[model samples]
Target: MRILVCGAGGQVGHEVVNRAPGFGLVALGRNRQQLDVSSPEQIAREIQEQRPGLIINAAAYTHVDNAETHAEQAYAVNRDGAANLAAAACQAGIPLLHLSTDYVFAGDARAAYRESDHTAPTGVYGASKLAGEQAIAARQPAHLILRTSWVYGVHGHNFVKTMLRLGRQRDALGVVSDQIGCPTQAGSIAGVLLELASRYARQGTLEWGLYHYSGQPSCSWYDFAGEIFRQAHELGLIERLPQLSPILTAQYPTPARRPAWSVLDCSRFEAAFGLAPRDWHADLGEVLVELSRLERRPLEAGVRRA
Candidate 1:
């Protein structure tokens, strides 16, 4: 099957493109520069030209704090771009698999969030993503919206990379402890999406709709940072482990309020897809090894060591 993967420059999109071939898929990847989702004309032209059997939209305006001030830009990409894709997919008689986030919730729930839970996004980024989800549901019948959290990978700017960079530079660091969420690996998400794609290829349908899929055993940022440092040290990706201090969210406030409880109940997804969530520790180890390999590569001009 031919799959069109948008936002190919992002972490999840990069993983999807690289791993698609192993699933017997022909993936056509388009970065923002190549196919900006915010531009309807560009999306229409690309969909027409590519004629892909499936479309996976990993494009998103993910800057939580920046979205507070840049609401228009955020909506342009997250909301309108998603609507455009859904409409085009509907017109083309194809299915769309779009990535979403746990931010759709208000973070006040004590229990893990289910797909049917009430949504009250507290910030612009979350609101925009929720709007995107709504748009897809309205426009496309054959759509799958996967809401994930704390996504990190080897190819993008994420919490894992930030922790690794800080661990190398500082002897000690503080991370927010009050906030809790699953640290999902980008490669694992890509693998799940490809598996679904393969199933759709064979069956020509899916029990599609909104679903929650995240890492198992939720932890705070502090805990995630500690794990990253431990794994990186074990892999020789980090020379030494940095001292980590757990602080409340108030100690580190941002323009956008992060979800205090981002844990998602992925039972519905597992039941529907028949795939279980992989242990995030194993995924973290794999990411650290990949980062190690990248660091060991001969550095070329304009390429800073990761």
Candidate 2:
């Protein structure tokens, strides 16, 4: 089956492209240069040329802090780009799998967020993503909107990489503990996408709607950073462990407000697909191992910036 993946350069997209062949899929991943999601014309041209059986959109303006100042660009890519892809998929009669974020919720709920929970985005990034969700739902009936949180991987700039860089550079580091969420691995998320794509290819249709998926056993940023350091030290990527300080979100204010509790309830997805959420600690260790293997030479040079 032919699968077209947008944002091929991103962490999740890169994983999807790299792993697609194992699933017996012919995947054509396009970066912004090959296919700009923000441009309807370019999307149409790519779709027409590729004629893929399935479409997975991983493109988005994901910089939460920068999205505040670049609201137009955010909406253009997240909202308009999603709409364009969904509409094109609808026209081509193909199933669309769109990756989303957990930030769509206001994060005040006492328990984990369900797919049916009321959405109240607290920042421009969330707002734009929510808008994209709405646009995709309205434009295309055959679409899977998978929302995940705190994604980190070897390929891109994410929380795990940031923690490693800081842990290597500074003797001590402070991370926000009050704000909590699932630290999902991009490889895991890509695996989920591939599973759905494979099913869609075989069945021709799926129970298409909104779904929530993330790593199991959610933790605060401080806990996540500590775990990263622990794994890095074990892998010999970081020679010395730094003192990690647990601080409140107020201590480190950013341009955008983050959800206090962004843990997603992935039961709906598990029950529907028979795929259980993986433990994050084991996944984190795997990521650290891969990072260590990839950066062994660089780490030998005294920790180069990723």
Please tell me which predicted candidate would have the highest lDDT against the true structure: 1
Can you give the lDDT of residue 179 in candidate 2?
90
Worst 10 residues of 1 by lDDT: 297-306
Off by over 4 Å in 2: 297-306
* Backbone clashes, each candidate: 0, 0
Error of 1 at 4 (Å): 1.0
Q: Which regions of candidate 1 fall more than 4 Å away from where they truly are?
A: 299-306
Per-residue alpha-carbon lDDT of candidate 2 for residues 90-120, written as tens digits (9 for 90 to 100): 9999989999999999999879999999999
